[model samples]
Target: MSRYAEYRALAQSLGVDAVALVPGPNFVRLMKQDFHSHERPLLLVIPAAGPVAAIVPNLELSSFAKLGFEGEVFDWMDQSGYAGAFAALARHIPLGSLAVEGQVMRVFVHHALATAFPGLKIVDAEREISGLRLRKTAEEVAALEGAIRISELALAEVLDDVRIGMTETQIEGHLIQAMFRHGASELAFGPIVAAGENSALPHAHARDVPVQPGDALLFDWGARHGGFCADITRTVFVGHASDEAQAVYETVLQANLKGHEVTRAGITAHDVDDAVTGVLEASVFADRIRTKTGHGLGREVHEAPYIMRGNRQLLEPGMVFTNEPGLYCIGGFGVRIEDDMLVTQDGCRSLTTFPKGLRILG
Candidate 1:
């Protein structure tokens, strides 16, 4: 909720003295083009060596004021010519060194800001800001908890509807309906209803096959509510899973559980990954591992501190993410076991609790 504070901390890290923000989301949030307000445009002014001030467009004056700002305000008017907006904004402070979110900010905005401070030092500020938001706050974790509840309920209903001869598309419809019924405003991502061979794709979102008896069904889905998201994946086998299918399923489940055992406060994401990697190597399905051990899931479905090779971010309390270990065999059946987790002060707690043991669906 406080993207400003995160940027302020970044400004401090970059040796800046103060910061400023210009409203940049007039086209999206105000225009109804996008539903997300967090992605709306905003300008951050950081004074690395001294103090900071704020300058905003006339149209954004009230919006900025609503932010309950405590610093100086330089309102820019644009009723006249092309330079009015830029000039008015530029009139706020004498430029020295400024950092902007180059990765997330639009190119046009970057160009305009650069033009206004041609003589001042302009630097890419993405890493600085992203580092500040790597940790989750209490309020943020609460929102994610709600999202997880809605999502798990949806999953339970989806599992209940599983029957032989149903197409993947039909399963997706039931999932969407369950999500809405459980309180999701919309899907956090497309509900993956892959059956048998489709499950081998890992990220297959298209649903186009009938679910037959004794086939692997992977449902990778999430739900969005109150501006938060939940991510979870679960795989099941229809009645009479082949020996290969059962073996892969059990191996994936063991890898998932092994990885979960190592997730705790103070543990690095790489540590958790290595724990699972060890179990995967020990198991016969080691060669079948096809994806990362897990990933951080909050705010955006995929965010900071991802569980991948060489990521050294320590698992901190209040952090929420996913532990989804998957195994894929080309042309053969694959399996994946996933669940949403919240990092507690001591260890991690699962948010989604639908039965994960191998289920033979018919």
Candidate 2:
């Protein structure tokens, strides 16, 4: 929100003058401040929309005015759809080949571009906008940090409800209640309350099966505050961890540690993934490292600079991401450790810290 200047600078880099941003100040706040609500008006607000010029949205949203957008505030009122509305909008776009968001913009309004403005060239601004959001501002980092703290508190309160003979549905309800009590705006994603062999699935949802003493419970969850989210997963043993469980958890822990160690400014996200793969390859159960090492985290739970095989994007200060490495064995069990990280100047800081070593839960 405080980055109008930054957006303008990006516009200058892209060689465009006068960006056409969709109006609705309140909606912008919702996108910036609420999870699952980040998609609205997404296509029209690319930071690189124009050079030293921002098309002020028609709808007034004073909340973001605090960020200082003292430039040209223009709009097409709902009533002026045909008069000074659309035509007025066409007049302000000064660039011959202006950039526009095509991905997240509503399909209904898309016709306005191709049919109404036959000469204007709207470039794909999604990547530029997403890239800008990949790096967290200080205020944005603080918001995520607060969200993480609340998530940790909620997880701690919900652990007691996990017991032998307890159904995954029952446990999920308790967890949701705890998250609400701690002020989570939403669940980062649906609570993953898998037990026993069900733990093998990485994205399992809470099911109706009753837990047994020997079940391996995997709690992969997150908490949302305002618009930011924190995802963390911790696998626990119902009675006593089996030998296979112990070995798999230790391997995952080693990979998570390596991922954390290599995560620093100037390093590419692929570096983290490669480091994790190295650990997994050296471990006895090497082939089971099922998913990409991790991904960048922020406004959207999953975004840019993904920690995968071929990514070359380097880490930078104020960039926030997740390091979630997992090992899954079919029909038996799985082990995972996930944490949010902030890339500082020299190294990165872990944002989710809810004890990742094996937990013996009864």
Per-model tally of clashing residue pairs: 10, 3
Question: What lDDT tens digits, residue by residue, belong to model 1 across residues 254-344?
Answer: 8888866778899888888888877777888778878888777765677666887698888888777788888888777678888877787
TM-score of each: 0.82, 0.83
lDDT of 2 by residue, 82-129 (tens): 234334445655345555444445554455554445676666666664
Per-candidate RMSD vs. true structure?
4.5, 4.1
Query: Model 1 residue 249 lDDT?
Result: 81
Candidate 1: 10-residue stretch with minimal lDDT: 24-33
> Each candidate's lDDT (Cα)?
0.70, 0.71
